[model samples]
Target: MTTGTTTGTTTGTTTGTVRSRRLGSTEIVYLALVGILLVAGVLVAVRGGNLFAQGNVSYMLTQTSLLGFVAVGQTLVILCRSLDLSVGYVVALCSLVGATTMAGDPSRVWLGVVAALAVAAAVGLVNGLIIASLNVNPFIATLGTGLIVKGFLDTRFKGPEGEVPFAFQTFGYTRVGPVPVSTIVMLVVAAVAFVLLTRTRAGYHMFAVGGNLDVARLSGVRTSRTLVLAHVLCSLCAGVAGLLIAARFGTGNALVYSYGLDLDSIAAVVLGGTLLFGGRGSVVGTVGGVAILAVLDTAFNVLDVNPFFKDVLRGVIIIAAVALYARRQIDPASRRVRFGTKVSAVRRGGVA
Candidate 1:
């Protein structure tokens, strides 16, 4: 009976370990992020004396919407093994155009919004074409396009007094039962993006193309079209983000928060466990990543830390996350060895 019990126990332990290993890498990263946030929240609450404050939670969620939208788009692009460095400038330009066009006419609000989206799509198409047809690297191509977009915005505004439409402002500022309109919009967009990327045939093709373009082409996937569509969707998301910002601020400044937006989006996506090299990620992870970033920023503010330090800290965290992710990809055996070594070291120290 004792021998049989020992064997059963060993079998159960092995089965449990196997089940744990089956969990997706994204899920593991997400849990790590959640753990980090929880620890931060606890520390902040211990210091500030409140974790359940309505004001703090609302402020964090509201601020998250901007980066959240951009991150969702970035997730899609990265999944396709491409990057969009132009999102920040594209956003600035779109917001400027939307704000300037809507400044006086509430009736033409929809028209301006449509035009902004069209321009964004056009910019994306140009990026896709340059990269695909001309054999240009996506990084350089998007960077160059971003510069052009910035210059155009600078020339268009020539100053900071661009008018934004009242209706557009309403979309940014209006609340639905204490939730900001922008937040609602972000959620809706995320949900739609999630469904498209996970539940559709195009999504499968996207994964195939990202993982191995040559293989994907040989498998009869429309690789070029998939790349173009990914960029278009990315630009569209950026345009929507710009519109939300314009509505929230009630004006369009040529350089308003453009510099940090792209970095934040990239960081958010990476932290969500999407491999920078591509072929893996989900909108759900991206949202959680956004929430983690937002929480970190809020915690910094509540603790009276310098806002500049937040950027520095964000850079550190992003680099660390990426490094860890890369290590996970390249050295699964190394991780296991490291884990065993640590355990042995701990036992030795305890014995000593």
Candidate 2:
């Protein structure tokens, strides 16, 4: 009986240790944020605040679904140490084209969607090709492409609104019970992205390339191809996001989101604990970041805070989070030694 008890204790200890190790620093940070948010949410609820009301929650989720999709793609691109500034414009153009093509044609909704996706993919391919072939910086390459695409969209849709089919719009408004379909789609996308990044060789190569381009190339990794593929995926994500937005609005607007989405996507990626330097992040983090942002927005609306102030708060939060992450990455031993030396210097000065 004593032997069995000892064995059970040993197994329990082993399980605890494994569980502890499985929760990495990023996961810990995420958990902390979640806890804080939960507490805040509860407080807001107890205050009889409208933000915690069911209607607000549903509205927030609906809004988040649109930008959350783009943010997911942005996280992947940023993970590879690259940025795609053109995502907003890509989304705008795709949305416009999709809506225009499906205008009043319920039977051809799928065709329009396929065509829009093809265009998005083609645009992404072009962005990848130019960046890879010319060795141009990704920012400049994608920005230029984005401008061209935006211009084309403006010319195509000049001064007129394009209607989307009623059937397609149903996806934006329809819910399975209380949950929005867009939210479900975002969740699925997040799940797929998480699996790809964590479980696939392609995901591994993406990290390798981002972590060290020269080393990855030397190790027979296709650095260029990986980057190109990353861009393609990023743009594809933007395209899907655009379609969802169009469906929600039931019309295609030229301005789409007025470039706010670019900042929002970056904010979501950084807030999710994905290092700005790349090669270390998860789709789960991105999703959490999105949720945090959405919750904050809902809170702000409930409190009736100025819209512009949210941007200021967001910037400050991003800077502080990145700084904290950087500090954590420093070696503990090195930090301790530095602290010791500082103490020694102070003691000597006092003696003198």
Per-residue lDDT over 148-220 for candidate 2, one digit per residue giving the tens place of the 0 to 100 score: 8878877877743667888899878888876899999988988888888889877888888778888988999
Q: Give the TM-score of candidate 1.
A: 0.85
- What CA RMSD would candidate 2 show? 8.1
Which predicted model would earn the best lDDT?
Answer: 1
Per-residue CA lDDT of candidate 1, range 295-346, in tens?
A: 8888888877787887898788878878877766764544555565566556
Off by over 4 Å in 2: 1-25, 39-47, 257-259, 334-352
Cα error, candidate 1, residue 186 (Å): 0.9
RMSD, every candidate, angstroms: 7.4, 8.1
Error in Å for residue 57 of model 2: 1.2
Instruction: Supply every candidate's count of residue pairs whose N, Cα or C atoms clash at under 3 angstroms.
Output: 3, 0
